[model samples]
Target: MASPTLTLHQYQTAASETDRTRTTKPTRFLLLGLFGEAGTLLDEVKKKQRDSGSYVGYEANVVEELGDVLWYLAVIASRMKLALSAIARPPEQSISSYATADNEIRFSDLQQQAHLPFAAPTSNFEITLLRLVAAIGALANAQQQSLPEGDEWGPYLREIFHILIQTANEAGVTLENAANENLTKIFDRWPEERHFPPLFDEASDIAEEKLPRHLEVEIYERTVARGPGIEKLYVLQRCSGILIGDRVTDNIMEPDDYRFHDVFHYSYAAVLGWSPVLRALFRLKRKSTPKIDEGEDGARAILIEEGVSTFIFAYAKQLNFFEGQHEGDLSFTLLKRVREFVSGYEPKHCPLWLWEKAILDGYAAFRFLQRHRKGRLILDLNNRSLSIKAI
Candidate 1:
């Protein structure tokens, strides 16, 4: 595979190209307008229902009004140049370099054959947050891409249903599973009420225990040249921002200003199986990330530094259930070192709901174009209808 030749300088140039990227403001304003109206309308409807006390008449209206709010979210995402694909993440090489030396980038970090699945579509504010986080976290975990899996916030929901189904199957949870089964519930709350139940648990034991794919992350070390506290979060945040890129216009954190609060928090919870991970992770003192005072220089500097890996790296990978399928993606040296781990367990049937789980959590269909020779997995929604693609 031909490796993509991306440099920190390339990212700098992209961000500094004030003339190249279009301002998303006009569409953003339009989304805000829609959001305002949809919110007011929903509030009025909700109020009426509350007053009536036995409100069951306009259920369809409630759904339609909620749909309107999601439409605005789509518009805002479009304005921001964000991919409406539910799960979003940074690139692979970036994640590979950061992770412990035992990982590879895979589709949203799943071991896969990019048969995009559907997750139980969710529109609730919290579920939306979960869907987005799952995408980004999977990316952070492996720095890979997948098929569009869904749409610009409309039918895009179908993809989540596909995912939810898969997640439930993997966790050995029933389709009627409640919030008690952490990973399974992520998929079960579909086909009926799409609203995500409150989180079952802070950590996903199923993911860590059952889907423990080995990672062969390339370790790169750097001496802290600036404030460690600020630099740590800044680098993490910058990784997410530029990785997320022009997609997601509503976020004002400008990539660099964003933090890995959610990513680190979630991972630590899952990995350590403890709450202390969150407290310990953020114990680093905070400092203000400096603004590039020299015209566009600062922004350029951050973009270059932060975006450098996304363009050049590969994160996600697909796993095969049996031996003899390493396909040379594994380096002989690393494989030799970890063959003990590989030999430790026989590959088992991964449940369908667990990505292995067979449930409708999100769209299972996607166009994950893997150019292994190039170390880049280009993603496309195949919006052949919309001609929309995310590279």
Candidate 2:
């Protein structure tokens, strides 16, 4: 029938004198890189504590470092070209931010929903780290001339949920469920499980073998270039293991420091002869998480939540929306070429232009990049759904 105004769903183009603000992506990367430095600093501080055996004396610096980490984050957004206008409403106004104050409050409400054990303040280093990271995304929102009288979490929180859900689905796991269950049990909001899922045994094998199929790839590559928002959470959930209460923390303190086994519960099926730790990590739990990262609510919130009124962004290497390949026989070996990029890599080195197009126009978003295709590419089902303009 009629052509659509926009090809897919994602952040709209910027338009305005205020929208002219630059230095957003750089801010985020700055904070991310700074955090890496902070982690190193934390490491050194810990080593000093161990050597001097006087960590209690330096307890205050620990807190100071946390604030420094967040401050760096706040400023990084400034460097990445993030601006108040971007978060409110654009200058020329391409997309309608689509966020509401009601949604902004959810970030705070999630913490109050149920009881969580040993829960730290929303300002805790871990929680604050994510919020600050997510907040840097304030610029991703459509900028506006004026803001309402009272506003809390800011607009960036909405994106965390959006990206969390999608990536969780693609990676094929229930870290979210574990996230929910842990909060429920620890907070006493819900009863505890009588038994723990068995220890995963197949993660290593799957790591070496390959991942499975996903449907959203077509839509994602078509839409975003990973400019901002939930894409942050999506990347986090994929690479690092997420945890909430003691259950989650305890899980991560396993044999070594591997939480993927606990969250995905994949390794449970590795069976002595079947696979390795990496492969087994992908087997235990194949169930997907919700559509967004609601912080403490974890997975149950997803099942109970309603329509998606939030906003998000993503990044992709290519956009071949028209994957005419056999439905069951898609994916490729190159899919494995991006473990670091897809999971845990974050947007440190990813391009916003690519993420924006992937989340909006799908594979077709790679029109400019496609000109460099050395030759037609081949399709192989061994890998997950990936690549653009396959031969």
Candidate 3:
């Protein structure tokens, strides 16, 4: 079965639905976003040029950036109260006639077009990209100059869209692919439907292999001797009166109380319902399925979770451990990096807001532990929460 064709108007309509800035400075916010995305696109291209031979994932990067660019263009058109197909009219065609023409930018069409040779050389493609950027800049210039909106505006935007289409063609990218990928990325960040995603081990036949819905982990500090006249504080955790993972210290010359960072793993399990490290610690590896046991519940997955916890701790250290930030306050760049860290893992299915909640809630519990040095970390996957109880 074929995926339904995505026409320009359909894309613009869908993209507009996800536009959070529709009410708040819609034009200005979108214009600024357009420029920022354009700069990002240019930067990706710059990296490809600079690292020509060694640059891996160049096409993927281009597709992502191009998707972003297309999204901004679609929403910007929506803001101007014009259909995307209206702005996509060819240079020689009259806008009125093209407006009603078939606006389909289908995957099959892209596949057919992708085989055709580029009309220009690689250098020309680069120049065309510059022209596209300049065209975007011209939109800002017109807005700043208080240019009147009228008949010429349609043709003006068409030219920019023309350049954009040309650039995508020369880069061997399809606008349909760009649009679809952009929708995926955006919806992954700000999903239209909000609900609890299914737990990673929800279907496990082994009851003990499932993450505990509610866990009360007692974490305390113990003093250990490193050398004569030297003592270091190590953190240890226990659940159901049985000692779990090894004792940990700050692992740095300066004591930042990172020994308490296990709270982050618990946060992942509680909020995202996926934590390989915690699963390993609690003997919850889904061994019933050999592939699941090795691939999803194995050492590499545990390392990825641990790496995410430590990486986020470092990021939070710079922000005072997200002291005053709200649930949605984590920067998109940080979330994007975290997503990249666990790109192939099960947790990658979780959305941005959930990641934010896990981080903030984990730090909330961590901050409490850092101050008190010991506490009961209460994780309720049923409630999707992490709470601290003074010990």
Q: Estimate, for each residue in 71-164, the C-alpha lDDT of model 3 and write its tens digit.
A: 8877777666666676775466566632343556443343446343323227877788888888888888887887555444555567677787
Of candidates 3 and 1, the better by lDDT: 3
Tell me which of candidates 1 and 2 scores higher on lDDT: 2
- Model 3 off-target regions past 4 Å? 1-4, 95-121, 148-153, 221-231, 241-243
Ordering by lDDT: 3, 2, 1
lDDT (Cα, 0-100) at 75 in candidate 3: 77
TM-score of each: 0.19, 0.19, 0.86
Q: Evaluate candidate 3 by giving its C-alpha RMSD to the native, one decimal.
A: 3.6
Give the alpha carbon lDDT tens digit for every residue of 1-391 in model 2.
1111211111111111112224345333443554453564345344554666544424333333332332343333333334322333322444333322111222112222232232112223334335434543443332232333122223442233333322222222222232332222222211122222222222435332333322111111112235655331111122223322121111222322121112111111111111122223333222332221222123432222111101111112222423342221223222222222333322212222222222232233233223432112112222211233332
Model 1: per-residue lDDT, tens digit, 191-215? 1223212222223343422212221
Worst 10 residues of 3 by lDDT: 112-121
Find the number of clashing residue pairs for candidate 3: 0
